[model samples]
Target: MSFTQKFYTADHHFGHALMLSETACARPFASTKEMDECLIDCWNSVVRKDDLVFHLGDFSMGLGDAARVESVFRRLNGRKRLVLGNHDYAKANVIHPTLAGLAWDAPPAAAMETIDEGERVYLSHYAARTWPGQHKGSFHFFGHSHGRLAPFGRSRDVGVDCPDTGYAPRTFKQLVSGMDLEPIVAEEAESFAP
Candidate 1:
């Protein structure tokens, strides 16, 4: 099947050493270095320089220096866009400034809407139980849960930590093709049953 140029992912937590600890995010990496390297490799492997990437939120953690964070962001492929996460603030400035310096586009809101393949897609850092156009076949994508929450209705977690996505950014085609929406649709229908 043909795919859209847009790819989605979030919660990279780059430079965050806790992500590699067994007691923290419980990532399988033995060290933060390994985790960062692997994530960068996985990202560049699928995303091209020309591709557009929608990173829902939490791109990095523990890297407080804007210059260092900017450096890391520059190394990643694709035209980047961000929906700021809670961890994104450092010192007195938002991370968007650094990203903007590198040509990354940061939408002002925590949530935004876009059209893809004739479908409305809601992008947010946190998942919502009921979103605009939820009953109109619109899709909602979010991060922040890190794969802990189950997807409902037409919503899906786009976090890199989401097991279903193999810790990499996924294209629109891949997400739709891989999703089995029957259960979710049936549940929604049941909710409306008298």
Candidate 2:
């Protein structure tokens, strides 16, 4: 019996035609329909009702525009998952009738079982200084180098890089014990990978 789930990984580069907040979207839209309705009203105003949003990837940029960003992520609420990045390979044949769920970059033991069980740790858009020295246990949240959230002067880590707009979304025990983040088990996730 262990029901503790409040994970969030950001990088909602939604449709991405361009113009993503150069001082809050300075006239740069060839499409993406106003950054997909302001990232679906800023991730449904900080995502609550059934929280569990793990993006950590581009989500869209092609593939017939991913059916208008999978119809606004199927009217967002929660329970979404996708680690497929690199512009989501033009959506790879869009499909997301059930909220959201996608996984790619196989072979890290098949992407570590597509994460479940209250998620002790596993996230990726990329950040591999060898992935904490070749897979260990839990804790590995990542996002393409928009990085900036230091605190690993010596050891144990719970990596960071979550921001899409004015960072707010939280949970995962307030993001790993409220910002004291230090959980990388096993090979110490390769000294916090990247």
Indicate which candidate wins on lDDT: 1
**Model 2 poorest ten-residue lDDT run:** 104-113
Give TM per candidate: 0.84, 0.28
Q: 1-194, model 2: which lDDT tens digit per residue?
A: 23434445555566665535554334344456765676567667777556666666655554454456567667766666666556555245443322233322231111222354444454666655444422434455555554454423111222222332343345455554444344445565555557
lDDT for residue 172 in candidate 1, whole number 0-100: 75
Candidate 2 segments whose C-alpha is farther than 4 A from its true place? 1-4, 14-33, 49-119, 122-125, 133-135, 145-194
Q: Evaluate model 1: give its lDDT.
A: 0.78
Candidate with maximal TM-score:
1
Candidate 1: where are CA atoms >4 Å away? 1-4, 91-102, 106-108, 178-194
Q: After superposition, how far is residue 123 of candidate 2 from its true place, in Å?
A: 5.4
Q: In model 1, which residue pairs have backbone atoms overlapping below 3 Å?
A: none
Candidate 2, residue 96: the lDDT equals 34
Write one digit per residue (lDDT tens) for candidate 1, span 90-165: 5445554554455675544567888877778889989987778776678889999888888776788888878768
lDDT of 2 at 174: 57
